[model samples]
Target: MAKIEQVLESIGAMRQGRTGRFSRGVRRGLYGIFDLTAMTAVLALVVLIYIRFYGEWVIDHRADALQAASSAVIEDRTGTAVWRASLPEGGYREVASAAEIPLLVKQAFIGTEDRRYALHEGIDYTGIVRAAAVNVRSGGTAEGGSSITQQLARNVYLTLDQTWMRKLNEASIALALERHYVKDEILTMYLNEIYMGRGQYGIKAASRRYFGTAELNRLELWQIAILAGIPKAPSAYNPVDDPERAAGRAKVVLGLMAEQGVITAAEADAAAVRAAAYEAPQQSVVDAAGTAAYAAAALREAARKTGLPEEQLRGGGYRIETGLDAAAQAALTGVFAEDAYFPPDMGGQQTEAAMVVVDHRDGEVRALAGGRNGDGAGLNRAVDMKRQPGSAFKPIIAYGPALESGRFSPDSVLPDVLQTYGGYSPRNVGGVYRGSLTMTEALTRSINSPAVWLLNQTGISQAIEFAARLGIELGSEDEHLAIALGGLHEGVSPLQLAQAYSVIANGGTFRSAHFVRSVTDAQGQEIYRFDPEAESRPAMSAWTSAALAFMLRNAVAEGTGQAARIPNRIVGGKTGTVALAMKEVSQAANRDVWFAGFTPEWTAAVWMGFDRTDSGHYLTVPGSAAAGLFSAAMGKMLAGR
Candidate 1:
């Protein structure tokens, strides 16, 4: 019995040990689970912090800054601003928000783009997660739950580059926005800031193009949907070009509206009907001609300064008066189409020409014709192409120095003969020496030997200094002896010469040359305006310029420029011809011909040359007729002025 009790005690002790072991195992398992749960909660908090603070805070501000900069625009003098582009790398304009935006249009845009806009700071993660889950199940970005603030953040500050870094930045900026501004204010800003296509930027411009009014409700739901898709691809989904694609995108917008409860299925169907009833609008031929790609290009360039998209500029409803004179434009364009002495029989290509007309009074550009009939016919030879000015540069070398030195005047006589200065020998045209011609007579005749002799008297550096002050951009590496003969290692543009001549025509005050004026953004903010920089130095004195003018007049009256003479007009001008300047050392290729001229009211220059491979031939006539085109175009283009 005692042995049995001992056995029972042993059995009971073993059972108790087993129970302790089991309890210890259970406790270990519970501790492991608690640690895991704590770690998971901490991770979730970290993710939430990133989404709430980094994604929402810092990144949102960057978006606003980039968007604000990209959305600003400069305006035309007519006050009509164009903006179809929101961002620009190499484009022309920059634009901003409308200063005079209609209040009703703002309300409509807010209602359409973000209904819960003013309530949330920026992102709504619950909605975003739901959209994400749906997106994963089906390959669609069809559901976007971003509030107006978040959308603005993405559009303005962030690039569309889908990198992990970019995603983090977007979230940070969105959160920052929530911490900073009130919801209503953000809504207003987003409505004014986002891009709508077709040079229409804001809701107001969109309303004008799609609905023909600034009021929003008047638009068919389809039109509204179409407008909504413009931010995605303005050029691709344009209704005028791809109606089917536009309609298809409209359905997607309608689907989103239904999902958001902004519209019902029944309402969406009715809106589709209203949209189908819409007939595409047609532009009047008159309006269409004036609103061409060229005008569009200029407006885009002007608009780029505003920082707004091109769409906003077209419908901004302000007059865009230009310095362009209609009569001058017509006359200048005709010159390119004028019969070319070159053959049409040479394989059916039309001769191309380019010209720029300027107002001598203030250096305002009157016209720039790129080609015949404004068709971009000629290589833009007027402004961009740089060719040797030939003898046309002689005025600066020969005439300018003479005036400044007080050693020679219009009436001062200089001996004209084959002259050697330093190691260089220069001869007059045709190598025929004419002795003792006055400054006026020498300039009219464009005598090279007399010019060289004058250089010996006055010094070449003095001539170059005069040229540089007048905006020639001539460098100091040149031999001053070359100044007498107008030989340089480089060339210049005719348009540049025209600008320089305008100063002399206007009593010697240099005005900056300009093609663009001002820019405004979608919100009507004047973002950039181009004004002439103040003159830091004088180009010349009026008395000296007047004396030079007296000499240039003799050029047309008695020299090689007699072909450019205009009856009943008091004109002053110069002619240039250089055998070496127009050819290679072998004299195989003729490079260029030039004529720079001015009347009492206008100044102009002309250059004709082959840029492909130098043509190895010279036009004895253009040195005659290039200058004549101005006299002819002047009668037609500037008849009134």
Candidate 2:
């Protein structure tokens, strides 16, 4: 009986302890509920205050929200964009609406980004929570919980710096965007506003840059996945620079889509195979000066004609439409690209060459080549290099001026013996001389003695006047008898050579040679126009032009310039060679050679010699080398016509 009473007492004590513990647990549960309720109320009040005040502030400034979103692109004659300028901050190309975006692309973004993007308003609370956990574990900003609208708000409305204040502003702006625009509009703005790698800003440009196509809908599933993964870390996943990382990111995007049932396992596998084989083309190495190399002369002309700085024109959102023929430029450049064109037998050591072609009818510069395989911008030899014209200068200095003098004609007799004038002696090549020859024979044979004798009779002043009329900028110190032998204080550029020859080709008319046809804004409103016809004026009489043309025609037909003869075509040309001597040097040094000519349709000039290299090394090659290149390039130019 005593043992049974002890057991009952122990059981009663245990029951009392359990009841007391249960009462304390109930109290602790109530306190926890109250704390959570208080926190929720505070969060609600803060959000309400933000929406009421900051949202109204954003709405008040809605007028300033939109920004310019187009890049200034340079177009070729055929309306093809060959180059694009840098985009301003908050700028992009044509926006693509969500509907225009491919469905596969959309699903890929949604799956890889916020899986519940459709359900979220502007911010995904679940993503934020998960990101917070991830960040806390990593001790860094390892994840961004931003939805598409949030990203758009951050890119357009707020600065890109990462900070709590910026985050708060981004959230506020994102909420406002969601209310102001529809879901599709928000997505469209986000897609276009984000920066893709390789200087591209929008989906349109990114599509064209990466895949070489602007039609995003035509992209394969793997391509769409690759693009979707790039926005997360553009530099790390840029397909052009880092293909393996891009492929890995793309695989992750595919896995996300498969998990979301957007694609099946077999489809994902097939897409993965395609993605493995995906490759972007290797970009060609462009000239260091970029498009400015090919278009430097054109840009200068634009500045001169518009009275604006070239820098201003480059940044003024203007589309420069040039009359530059791509094929002709290519053909001309290709002729000089071959090392064989400058053979060692021709004294082509360290030789550089330049050529310029103009459509004399309209003064449009058709082709301009500065150097072989050059960067195109530096020292544009065609327009910038000014060297002695050698015998090539005779047409402007001796023959044209003599014809314009009204005292000389193609048939006029001139003395070609060894002559000395004021201690200056002129002799023909190889020190040979023809006693007396007609002006036509003198020019066709490039007899130096007769050219000097004519200058003695006609005077240097008349040659200066003729060159000036032809728009060749002669130096003040160029008043000398040596001018008769293509000696000028500052020689002429290949561009000037081509332009001056145009007067002979086009019946003595002087038309300013230029490159740009017009410059317009993005809206196609013309800002500048080149009027070649209006600029045309007679530099010499028709009789002088006829006489000069007759002599020049004979040059190619039966003269030193025979190498430039294009079969089956009425071609005319002149050959020029000058022995250059530096200070303390004599005339037995390196020589500069030239060939300047014109047909009815074109006027071209070719210069070959060592300009920046050793001036002591003479070019053994004759002017014929330049003429051959000129002939070949001109042949291609005429073929395209």
Candidate 3:
């Protein structure tokens, strides 16, 4: 019995040992299989990431996609493209090569935008992790981990969406850029591709726009810091828009440079001081003669005529041919730029002025100035602003229509006394009434009562029709005797007034006032052409136009417009002044002053006033102020003719 029990125990122990050995072998085999599968999956992920980093699409389309769009060229009458239009990105970009980029500019940008730009490959995994951790802690995106190459990739190839897909794409493209281009080349492209503010792209364009120079090497360290800071938030840090904010941002950039050892602490402190004191160059990037207004107007006209959007007109590489006589435009610009040509500042606000010159022979806008000191793209007052013509409207709405009626002649006598039409009393300027005066004398003296009387006699409907024939459209609201004194519901623009006077200058023919003469596409195919004949029509009889011209010539020669007389030219003009809204304001404190005048070859309208018409901002000068400016500008234009 003992032998049998021992044998059984030994058998059970042997079976238990065999079962444990089998179980251990199966567990080891399963662990080995799981390890192999995990290793294979990781290897596949690495291979996929490598392939994405070296994307064929990114490499193939890089050159073409990165190429900047060509700017549309706006040419003057001489076919010289004096200006280049803004690109689709709302600015002008002038690409600069690595050689053109200065060392300080590069250092400033790298220090401020990407401190680890030199050390990072395309994707900064450590930075991403750090930024992600911070964002997670804050529950918001408070920091960016993108390097310079990533920014370039996003600017050139991706939208600014915060989706994971966009991030993936940006990372892939950035990796591709790093793989293909050297560090210096990538930095150069990044500098040339970034947008700084105020319709400017690239450091070169920003330099030219803000500092008034395209020479990057000449930029001060403060200016370089300004350029560096602009890319983070362009609109917020634009020096032209907000100098204090821009200086603050620039100080931060300078500090970054100091921290990076690119600049010493003392150097950074000096740059910060200069940055605080910096002012945008008053001189525009446009020619010193200031063809910016003309170029802007020409671009607008090109867009209207070609049925293309202004953006397409700007960057489609179209050639816009304008009627801008360079000499005439320069003459107008020069007159506006001169402080002496305008009234002294009132209430610490300088007077603003606009002028438009048209060639009556073809109704081409020869020259224009939108404001006293413009940077080429703001409010183009000549074409955009409409102000009361005052006495300047007498010829268009009253005298011209009266003459065409055959009921009045230059010598016809009319009363210049205070008169009322339906409780609307029209008084002569200064309330002095000449009981009766010849039509020529009334016009020459710019008597308001006679103009109202003449319009009453001509009939408001007839006068409106006649004015329209001369390219001065009046609405139903303007069907009142007050229109004779330029009191229309909607006043006329400088361009409109110039066009109306052009009919008299050209002996009764009216042609549409236009700036763009023609436009050609990138392939030089004519897309638009202004046909003067198509826009031509007889606004009045030659006899009436001649009589009116004779009277206006007399006005310029001996009457209120005497200041507009140009020697050796058959100058004809009318002086106009709109009173301020407040009756308490002195008569001399006018809201607008104008001189609409013409020579045999050219017709022009000059307007000067404050943009606002409050008592503190009213013009203290008379119409003669604009007349004198007209004389100076016209003399310059006629000199070369």
Candidate with best TM-score: 2
Give the per-residue Cα lDDT of candidate 1 at 391. Answer: 72
Best of the two (1, 2) by TM-score = 2
Ranking by lDDT: 3, 2, 1
Candidate 1, 462-535: lDDT as tens digits: 87777776677777666567755557766666678787777677677777654455544344465555555653
RMSD (Cα, Å) for all candidates, in order, is: 7.5, 8.7, 9.3
- Model 1 weakest lDDT span, ten residues long: 284-293
> What lDDT tens digits, residue by residue, belong to model 3 across residues 199-294?
777888788788877688898899999999999899999898999999999999999899889899999999999999977777553444677788
**TM-score, every prediction:** 0.67, 0.75, 0.69
Ten contiguous residues with the weakest lDDT in model 2: 283-292
Q: Which of the numbered candidates is closest to the native, going by highest lDDT?
A: 3
Candidate 2 structure, TM-score to reference: 0.75
Local distance difference test, per candidate? 0.61, 0.78, 0.86
